[model samples]
Target chain A: MSFALNGRPGVSEATRERILRIAKEMNWRPHSAARALGGARADAVGLVVARPVETIGVEPFFGQLLAGLQAELSAKSIALHLMVVEDTAAEIEVYRRWVSEHRVDAFVVVDLQVKDPRIAVLEELQVPSLILGGPGRHGGLTSVWADDRKAMLSVVEYLAALGHRRIAHLAGMPAFHHTARRMRALRDHAKRLELIDAVSIPTDYSDAQGAAATRTLLARSPRPTAIIYDSDVMAVAGLAVAAEMGVSVPDELSIVSFEDSVLTRIVHPPITALVRDTFALARQAARSVLAAIEDPGSARDLETATPILTVRGSTSPPPGDAIHETV
Target chain B: MSFALNGRPGVSEATRERILRIAKEMNWRPHSAARALGGARADAVGLVVARPVETIGVEPFFGQLLAGLQAELSAKSIALHLMVVEDTAAEIEVYRRWVSEHRVDAFVVVDLQVKDPRIAVLEELQVPSLILGGPGRHGGLTSVWADDRKAMLSVVEYLAALGHRRIAHLAGMPAFHHTARRMRALRDHAKRLELIDAVSIPTDYSDAQGAAATRTLLARSPRPTAIIYDSDVMAVAGLAVAAEMGVSVPDELSIVSFEDSVLTRIVHPPITALVRDTFALARQAARSVLAAIEDPGSARDLETATPILTVRGSTSPPPGDAIHETV
Candidate 1:
């Protein structure tokens, strides 16, 4: 049967035709389990996300990224086995179970943590896994990552050039490795630029937190002339907060989104953003993971192009004598 | 092995303990395929979506809905086999393949069409499938749906009462049964209330289309005093269009989003929306599909609660003399 199916030399053409006809008549297809038993590809990839369920819906990043992933993965008829877990512990448990059960050919690890336990777990499982974030601390695993430090530094330089000396960063969860990288970039650059006030406030990447942080920042005695948000949803929420508080965007206060999406482009005064094509990034990640699965240990750490600053309607020169703020 | 692992009456406690310890030491687990061969559950559900990949990412509905589905399905360790296909044909192909391969125990079909082909395919396959949107035309499959017509009628009633007679609807794809339902409900209710110039314009539900539609509508002579959007992303985009065109929301033109998310709430002059908890709806769908999987024909059609009107800062009576537009 294998010879016939593979068109091997031993199988006669007549026998092959008969076998194929019978298989068509019986609607026979290779079961994923049978394939697994034969040590063939499972034709599935596992993506276990650890985030609050509520946050997953409103955030556009995952939705767009999944689109790119699904587009690439579906062309090969490989299903994406997605599971949203509560935390990293549950995430690791999922990886372990899937590995032991031979449920998937590969895993796409996302939301890289500062001290990720899943790295050790995946290494022990000896599964072909691709990390979605990071150039380091991934423990010999292949990674596809955008340079967060470089992107953040470019955003700061752009803002500083616009005469924004006092800037506040609305960052995502502090535990994420990319988040740490972004914060460090901002802290180091702010000191180098000799800024009067530079601060980083970490949030859970929720619009509610974004709004609350924006309100607090704007209410300060000499409010920061600019604010940078980690996500597009947060940037839009912050813009709404600015609108409600009567602070004119790009006039009194400039805003920049670290991530870009339709949310950033559609809002009033259209947010300035560090634009990295997330869809393309996810497609590249998908291709890399597929490669890793096909030839284990062949996928290497890939550093994607840094996000370029696209200055939209949201950023401009700061208010009052801030022209002197430019170094 | 089964008797000892199950701790059956014939198996001694010591024997069962030894069996379990040995199994643990050997790092053995029940293979999903082995279970399938034994006619047990596949422990997975299939959700094949047919939509443009670009739309999937920007749209918040699927993201939120998937979050809900994952939360419920994860508790039982049932993986969601998600596949995004190009169209209905590809979607049906995936269903057939997944069914024949025994990859999923059940299917959760969404985006019900005016003439849904997948319904018949699932029924013929004798698979336990649940439709996500439908109170009708489902052909014996269990469904979990909110009242789209009733929800639309209520939205129209609310808007008409606010003196918006010249109302326009920015609808989603006309091929969708729910889209047709909502459009019909708006048309029927408009005539019943004796309103003037009520119309619906179908769109692909992108922010680009939403903005374009808004611009085209706003530029018309005696343009609509109110516009109802099918999605929150579109509503926000429409709001930005109004701002760009110098049309004040709820002053000259009121806006309402049929679906709501943080996008609606976080925007400037927060949009009024028909609030249905999509997360809750998805959980219900997950439960319904799981039950359908457990007892092949037991799951029944369930109509969830109709979305309630949540009027925020975006709705108001029409401007000036148009107050008399109220019936």
Candidate 2:
């Protein structure tokens, strides 16, 4: 049992591999209680999503991320125990339980809110976890993330170059760490292209809100010529709203989504999107947590990939107002 | 422990409720070993998805079902442990692990293939499980399902009424139990309509495959006047392909997707889709598994809802072919 449970010097590497294969084939796993008594190492990772269960279907980002994360973990023979909690409090409670009971070796944390409450909870338990966002405030945990600021700058740069002097960013929930960071970057970049009017619209990342925001933006006397959405769902929604209002895409307006997935490509006049490998990032997050579990010293925070802006049918020279909007 | 576990008469109902709440809030789940020794009631549910993990982003159906299932499970404080396996053998292996270790009280199963191997595995283990499709070839497992055959018939009937005689069903992988059922029904309904050309094209539930299928169907000398896709992604892809092929939607071709979600509604010329409440169906599946867990005798297979067709911009009288092929 000891030979199988831990990678130790006593067992030959080949023998250990054989033992693991046989054990796996026989469906042998250390019982939770027995493993607890045997001391730590649940041989699994846990992720408790604090978002409401309703959000899972509306957002492909979560599904894509988990697919990548799960693939990496499963390849390492690491089981992912996922839980859906209603809010942060429920999430913290699950965290405390998993930590106290040693139900998981480490955790893959996501949905980073500003001054996230779960951070302190995980810190108190001293469990090794890897956050899937930038290290905000303080850190007991390492992280893997894309350069959101750079990505935001590029989106603004692309729109500005397309003669879009008045651009609006349909931002995700205003309070998230990444959302705030991206919004700041948008403002900073917009300022660099002076006389450019970039208004940030705070949104809850829903299709309804996205459509409502679309109506609000387009109804303005001097409506923004281009709009960048924080999600594909919102972008797709905005596109539908544009069509409903008789606004010809790229002729009357331009639509760009922050994340590229199936939705972006499947839409008519495929959206110009900032494409990132969410799957690879998820895999990296999984690997980071495992590394933290096995050898804490070797684990380091990572910035996985640089998101690239792809111009599909969404961007064009701003409709008749690019030069006129300049101060 | 017995009072809380068994809900025996010794404990007051209020006290039982309070005890359960506290235990859950405390994340103080009874250890699986202790539960095994005590006999029955693991207080958790398992769902093992047997598909390539990469497909999660491309498919919205999985996320929608999980969201609904998770909500129902979370309400009862029943932990949901999800696993992803590549094939039947891996899925069976997961079942064995969960069964032997009492890791889950019951399971929610999806993706029922023809002559499914999981049924044999589940029957041998006698673990309480609820399949997520119609009760087709009869197995020990109970299921909660929407009326898929009726849904298919209605799609063909609507298209026929729209003056589309050369209609094709863009079928999901034909090996799936539901796909075969829907295809058979589509053929039967079309024959009743006396259409000269009514065919089913198999697809792998990916946008690329959907587009390729669409191209192949359209390139034929006498192309399908209308097409019904297996998924929203496929329908959306078919719509894009139609645009690229210079065939106007609902004019040169009418399009319908079998499963409806945000994707169907968001696209330009919004797809005429058979809208089933997948979320509610999933909740029913979750409840079915839970009921089976609490009392095996009380659980029975259920037929839940009938899917309804919603006509949108994508379906209309076929352009020139509308008059030619009618009986």
What local lDDT does model 2 show for residue A225?
Answer: 89
Instruction: Name the regions of candidate 2 deviating beyond 4 angstroms.
Output: A1-37, A297-299, B1-34
| Per-residue lDDT of candidate 2, residues B1-327 (tens digit) | 534345454445654455445334333434455556466465568888888899976688888887898888877766677777788888888889877767678888888887887887887787788988866643868888777788888888878787788888889888898999898897777678878788888888989999999999989988888999999999999999999999888878999989899999999888899988888998888888888887766546799878899999998888765657556
In angstroms, give how far residue B78 of model 2 lies from its true place.
Answer: 2.0
In model 2, what is the error at residue B142, expressed in angstroms? 2.0
Scored against the true structure, residue A172 in model 2 reaches a CA lDDT of 92
Model 2: per-residue lDDT, tens digit, A39-121?
A: 54665688888886887987998888879888887766566777788888998888887766566788888878778877777
**Each model's DockQ score:** 0.38, 0.31
Q: Residue A140, candidate 1: how far off, in angstroms?
A: 1.9
